[model samples]
Target: MTISNLQEVKSRITVFGQPMICRGCSHEVFIPYELYINVEKPGIGCLYAHDIAICQNCGEARHFSDPSDFDNEKGIFVWALRQYVC
Candidate 1:
């Protein structure tokens, strides 16, 4: 499918060889999105990027850690924001 159609595919998205199923409605389709979570606190939180999929049926979101890890394996995987959601 084309990138434009990807959001509408409504099909199972696999992560690490596993199918993503929505737990809220048992839906097999999702709208893929990338999100960053603040893993740090007290100061500038660690903005870890994640590959997220939102259930098209129930609006539930599931996240999968990005494999890149910004090429850092240590130091809590710190990195700068490089992804844009909108």
Candidate 2:
């Protein structure tokens, strides 16, 4: 992605009201939510998904197939646990 495009995407992202604790470092930080658009080639419809989370403290990241599944209590807990173990 070009710098301009990345900047635009970053500006448009919606962050959660409540920050989540970093799974790797336990630091509280807002989890950014964004729609990722993928276009393999012209004429092909774009594929979109909301699926990325990066821990600001430790630089750990997690990806989900579906964005809607993220941030749910169970998912968050599991993610935190996994990070802790890893």
Candidate 3:
């Protein structure tokens, strides 16, 4: 999370950042993304999405995926709700 101008407060991350919208309530804002940072070796200072944030109300999830090539390949991070009950 080495975003130069990144500012965060409570559950919502703000200021020109990507909107992490809650699947349950559209008005709710969030930023509980667990990111994997590359700093040991190889391409240093690389940020990859590698965590899961589940919607408490709806019991859905948002998976942050890291592609094969961190630099070349693109990361696919999306908010997908699991709509079902047993």
Candidate 4:
């Protein structure tokens, strides 16, 4: 998806791999294995190119997984923000 601004793609994002930081505790989390939510429509190319994100301070749950499954951008962010899972 070609987005002119980062905000356009902000909602279709998720966290993968090592933890960057925590949202609540500000703790740095590390994953020996891939600790992230699976993307809904992660076809072929998108497998390696995950939009995973994590807190850089505390390992709390910021963005969970990719919301590419959803068609609407606003809906994706709404879902993500509601669960705090992402």
Clash pairs detected, candidate 2 = none
Off by over 4 Å in 4: 1-47, 59-63, 70-86
Collision pairs in model 1 = none
Best by TM-score: 1
TM-scores, all candidates, are 0.49, 0.36, 0.31, 0.22
Please, what is the whole-model Cα lDDT of each candidate in the order they appear? 0.56, 0.40, 0.42, 0.34
Q: What does candidate 1's lDDT look like per residue over 1-86, in tens digits?
A: 22222343355665444566788888767766656778887579779766667787889987644332334445464332122122
What ordering of candidates by lDDT runs from best to worst?
1, 3, 2, 4
Q: Kindly indicate the candidate among 2 and 4 with the higher TM-score.
A: 2
Q: Which should have the higher lDDT, number 3 or number 4? A: 3
lDDT score for candidate 4 against the true structure: 0.34
Quote the positional error of residue 84 for candidate 3 in Å.
29
After best superposition, candidate 4 residue 28: deviation in angstroms? 12
User: Residue 68 in model 3: shift from native, Å?
Assistant: 16
